[model samples]
Target chain A: MPKKKSEESKSNNKGAVRPDGRKVDELRPVKMEVGVIERANGSAYVEFGKTKVVAAVYGPEPMHPRHLADPEKAVLICRYNMLPFSVEDRKKPGPDRRSIEISKVIKDALSTIVALEEFPKCMISVDMVVLQADAGTRVAALTAASLALADAGIPMREMMSAVACGRANGKIVVDLTKEEEDAEDAVDVPVAMSSLTKKIALLQMDGDMTLEEFEEILNKAEEACSKIYDMQREALLNKYEKEGKEVNINDE
Target chain B: MMSSKLTAEYVRSLIERGKRLDGRKLDEFREIKINYGVSEKAEGSAEVMIGNTRVVAGVKMDIGEPYPDMPNKGVLVTSAEFLAMAAPEFEPGLPGENAIELARVVDRGVRESGAIDLEKLCLVEGEKVWVVFLDIFVLNHDGNLIDAAGIAAIAALLNAKLPKITEDYEIVRDELTDPLPIKDIPIPITIRKYGEHLLLDTTALEEDVLTGKFTVTTKINGNICAMQLSDGMSMTKDEVLQAARMARDAATKIREKLFKDKLKELKKA
Candidate 1:
């Protein structure tokens, strides 16, 4: 669909039914798979409705260039790339300004969960590719990457779950699709939290809302993230279950 | 960035015997996979994989003034980026020599082949013209990034379309008009010389021991459009000619196998 028409639809549908016919605070269906790529130390694939992402983890290996190595903790590098066909328009294949910024935030979000001090002078790399994109791809990528890190056997405090909430057509929505995201006056707030501790690890906002609206969005996102966290844990369990080994998240 | 001496010596011994460590013949290529329209934000894009090596190319078209030297024709700007996550050896920063060389080689092949009719892109002669930007990105660096990037660039260009243009010289980005003017397919073939053996499509391990490398870009008519020789070890004239012939054959095979199906699909779309 053209950008103009999508924008127009956003305005015309104010206070009306959503395109997907879900409640204002409902999330799109999510699916996750672990150990998807053999080349990387660990990998995962995730789908949040129409958005699809693949994440790969490498290292706890030695850092390159020598100088970038930290003396006390491992350095984390995250990269997010959207494939050319991932969206309505073909995206250029590299790290543009948006991707670079997204990479930094993802790295920071995952850093809180990873026990980087356990591997001194080492590096942990996370690579996420958006095979298809609708909206909230950055959050989806981060969610998959966190799972990949755990699958790689990297020690961490807890797994992270990320979700985005926003105001669409004057109503708060838990997860916005591409069309809703393009709507004018839409306010997006993406939040990530530790599943075990419920501690916020990442928060970002665009557009505007009242403090009460922001808090309401946060509460809704937290609720959605709890469900997402269970899904992530189940994906890990499924992989280990297939290997015929009984695994426990708490034991690890 | 350097391979162990023991591994290098082992590779050389195998090459001397007309065998590679991967159990393939000296002239054998690794498996290749190509997918078109991998990005939706650009005019055209493709992702290509040669063995473990992966590269993506995206083409974006915009209106701009023509270059002083080519005022009557459109312009093609090519650039390459090596993602730090692709390989441990690749660091995050500006483009280095390898990145620059890769972009130039791919650019030269496409430009010299007359693949795109630049004259058709001109909005107004010497005033405004359509500038085509080909951005190549290395997503994985197992080896042989040149050939993979070249293939991606060609595939992306083949899939490109021009946005609708208005009479007042405004470009309606959301409405695409027609496919870009593409004339020929240019394929690049790179051969690595390692210890008296010319190996085609060397893996990362083999690349460390290679003393010389030669790349030949061939067009559909069996004409050489661009040729580059990275000097490390010297090559005889006959050796160069033999490598060129091998490259032409490889290009032809690749065009038939990898490009034909995609071309047909694009035409139907």
Candidate 2:
């Protein structure tokens, strides 16, 4: 609730300033790294401001309980979990209504882009663990999980990015803080997008807003997610470069 | 029987020509049939059939302590029970993720809208309040369960009677007092993307091969109460906007055709 630096609202010109003094369009500082876990086939860590998540991918292997396996395609399972200490209150370990819903949404988002047909009768698992408490954890987890999949060498149509954009204090902003997210007037919309394809992989909205407000936020989220997409690819390329592997990430 | 791969290919072949296996248009929903007051004991009930997909929703009232956060508001719970007889793949045990998502989508749509006027359900502010339970039972899974369940919920809630509150702060199960305080009608419109086509109210066969779906719950005033995109599919920014626009139009059609009297009453009010 404290302002560090004063700035004007960029797009809406509502004359409303963010609580944290960020521009309406400015995203929080982001950090992304791939291959963070050596034991996992692929793993990545992503942070958006105070929110942090680590994602690991394992699969295209034999699926347990053969009945759940797809004979012509791989089954994609995603679990989004938060460490007990990730929040202010000690969250009881295990999936609650919130976590179960979050996990399902993340899985649905990933299922669209992953090339499941490439591995028949196999299963792919993507696990994301939140290490810090903050708003936009689902988006953070999704951003990390996609990178983990790419790092695992699992085929994908495109590398995706996710972000939460909403209205706080009557001004549209990207990557809201937990404080702003809980505000009465908040209009929280979490989205996942593929920049190159101009596709929306996941979308969910809560709080209150008009149709026009929702549309404006969607445009903003698209721009923010595309920017995050570039950052994700850069982090991935950096990983390959560090490993001394010649990965010519072609524009095609 | 054709293999799933073959059936999928056959379905896609039909969709490529803007056709459906059942001779319906790309955006055409199957005929919706509604039967009210099927349950005499329940406070409210409705059976909705979209094509061969049948679902029943029942409303029951309970008196309970209010939650700490909002003591003045009553609680609304929407749950779905998928019967094994509904489909071969469905088991009789716990509610699966699909059932949970169906319930949640319905719940959010109802709660986000001022449909029930939760504040009015409160009797003794922080102590006693009415807890409304809306349960959806799937008797058949022909596809597009969300829309059916959503419609049944709103329909049942519209006709639901609030049980009389006793002097002792208890609910009289058999004695009905008045109708539930219904304000807005939120209709969930599910439009899916099949290749480049945006299909509405798909049947079971068509749902199997669809790439993406957007379940947007639009209120009568054209404002959105809830929105969800299912599966790991992606749509262009244009497509996303198109879906929202489409939802509003479809919701309007559904309201005019089904809840004509209700909307007329709402307008008169």
Best-fitting candidate, measured by TM-score?
A: 2
Task: Tell me the tens digit of each residue's lDDT in model 1 across A1-252.
Answer: 101111123334444467776667667767789999999999998888888899999998999868989999899889999998887778988877567657766776787679999999999999999999989998999899999999999999889888888888878898798888767667676777778867665555555454456557767888888888988898898888866544454456
| lDDT, candidate 1, B1-269, per-residue tens | 37888998998999999998989999988899989899888899999999999999999999999987678899999999999999888899998656776787788789877788899988899999999999999999988989999999998998899988899889898888789898778898988885457878988888887754677788776766665655233344345557778888999899988878655553465
Clashes of each: 14, 4
* Per-model DockQ against the true two-chain complex: 0.01, 0.62
lDDT of predicted model 1: 0.82
Task: Give candidate 2's error at residue A185 in angstroms.
Answer: 3.0
* lDDT (Cα atoms) of all candidates against the true structure: 0.82, 0.87
Report how closely model 1 matches the true complex, as a DockQ value.
Answer: 0.01
Fnat scores for every prediction: 0.00, 0.68
Among these predictions, the greatest lDDT belongs to 2
Clashes, model 2? 4
